[model samples]
Target: MDEVQVGAGGATDFARWTGEFEAKVVARAAAGDPDWARGARLDPAVARSVQRFQVGESGDGANLIGKADRAGDPVYSAAVRLFIAEERNHARLLGLLLRAGGQPTLSGHWTDAVFVRLRRALGLRVELMVLMLAEVVALRYYRALRDGTTDALTTQVAGLILADEQRHVPFHCQRLRVAFAASSRPARLFAVAVWWVLMVGVTAVVAVDHGPALRQFGVRRADFGRGVFGLFAVIVPSAIPLRDPVRIA
Candidate 1:
């Protein structure tokens, strides 16, 4: 990945994002990976949960890249490629974590299948909206996995993925801010409403699906849902300004 720095006001600076991602790639290479040889001890439920998330992260991202190319922003397109690479790296990390725990990665998961279908069913803006949902949900999940687990290797892997996911959210948000910049107030408000509904639905599904694992980490299902909502509260305003925003020239 490259090194990227969001400029003042978090402007749409894809070049910075590209550099950041590249820098991350360099840093990751230099740091190397966690010692998988130590092995991990994962609860059965947690292993199952991680398997599903691994499936979610394991995608070619061809559709997203195609959409980005069609968007006609070459810099953004390049940055998106690095973003996808990082996501695939997340899958790799999770798979290795499972292996360390003597578990196999799932061949597929219904939740991931549905999510991929939903994201690919629309244009880049819509795709990004759907992707943002995953990114935000992952924020809470990886945090719990990192902080709640006793296994040092599992914690390390989760922490790494969490770091990338934190970057991913605002990166997508910056693009989406531009995407909605030309919309009317009424339109923006409507988008905010719709986004809220979708977020609630998705969070509920995830909480229900990962309930056992979340409980293992001492996170109540309701608490998980609330946490996701809390995160999205910030995102909705950032991504879709309901008030008339000064156009970014």
Candidate 2:
């Protein structure tokens, strides 16, 4: 499949991955290994949240590209295409990690429904900014796991996922820059407001729920904080300059 063109939609592949992952999770759960089961369970909620985030904004991102294509915004279109592809890959990686850990794939009904509503209510720029916030949270979570885990498989999976996520940083930042560039003054202020809300909201949710889970996995919560801060430092610098026009393709 050409990377330049959006490949056939990922729904079919995503379904297959979901089924296979659930089966693996069920098997692991039945094995009666608490550590394994618990570790695996982490994958489900995380996957559900991510699935919601992606499905919610994917169409807007696509529509943006479609508009850019019509308007001959090749650079933006190409970047958006890469963004879509990265999101698709991200969904797959989350599924894979869940399966490897032996957790069931949670029903994404709520996320899907939410995405439907989000499509109607939000613009592409707002949606994309929200996605960046999600990714920032994910990068922190994954990095924490990768750094704090002693399990070889967990570390391996986390590392692999992190690699893909790292690639997304630039794509998301570029999209944010483009969106900012195209926005009017009022829109820019609104975008900043929305971004602040998302970032704060996501951080709060992560702080509340993630601590217990990490403790269950024998990971120190402080270590998670360190990982998150480390990621924040790196991502903030990279994302700041994104307001400047740069060639991403």
Candidate 3:
């Protein structure tokens, strides 16, 4: 199947995952545990960051799937759909943490709005590359949180989520490699520019928001850089070979 078809199928899968995720969030919300609520309130910065995280997942995932659907590619669509599913699970995990601490979970609308505007301005491939970079960064953050926290539940949830994020790096890089390979010289150049911009932008955001949370959690901010490098080392090298023409499945 073509990239467009794959994207469309991924969008449909995203929609399905969104519904399932919503159900889980609602159930967790109703549970109303004080420790969960306290944890939710433990770090305002972290809460805001998680809210932004959800927004990116919902808005960006929807946009990617929508574009891929228009273009018609089942493989691309399926990969993105899997992305949406994983993101939804991340949101649900955050929601569960919020509920356990006894705080209200914020909606993902803010991040979604930011993503929508960015997508219109940047185009799909650039947007996706940036999103992937952010995901890779997030995977590192979560992994650190998992390792640092002694709370059994927090550790377990973060560990599971981190494992899923490990899968995301390759999937995202695969799609990006395929897209870049299929493009002309000019398109590739444009993609490179966008990749740098995204890398810088996400790095700035992480520095401001996620950085402090790590400190509060008793982890050093420098660890984030190391983690990002680790993720890049794994993903970028694997993607290099496919820069010319690659089958993404």
TM-score of each: 0.95, 0.59, 0.69
Every candidate's lDDT: 0.89, 0.51, 0.58
TM-score of 3: 0.69
Across 32-84, the per-residue lDDT of candidate 2 in tens digits comes to: 32233335434544444434433433343555555446645555555556556
Best by TM-score: 1
Ranking by TM-score: 1, 3, 2
Off by over 4 Å in 1: 1-10, 244-246
lDDT of 1 by residue, 1-249 (tens): 122222223366688789989999999999999999999999999999999999999999999999999999999999999999999999999999999999999999999899999988999999999998899899999999998888999999999999898888878988988888778888888888888899999999999999999999999999999888888877777778665463574
**Any residue pairs clashing in model 2, and if so which?**
25-102, 25-103
Q: For candidate 2, which ten residues in a row score worst on lDDT? A: 1-10
Error of 1 at 16 (Å): 1.2
What does candidate 3's lDDT look like per residue over 1-249, in tens digits?
111011211112233433544554476469533244334334665555555654455443666777766657665666566567667767777668656645566664544566567766655566666566767777777766677655555666676666666656655555556555555656665655555566656665676666666776676666666656555555543443324444443
Model 3 residue runs over 4 Å out of place are 1-48, 58-60, 108-112, 120-122, 184-190, 240-249
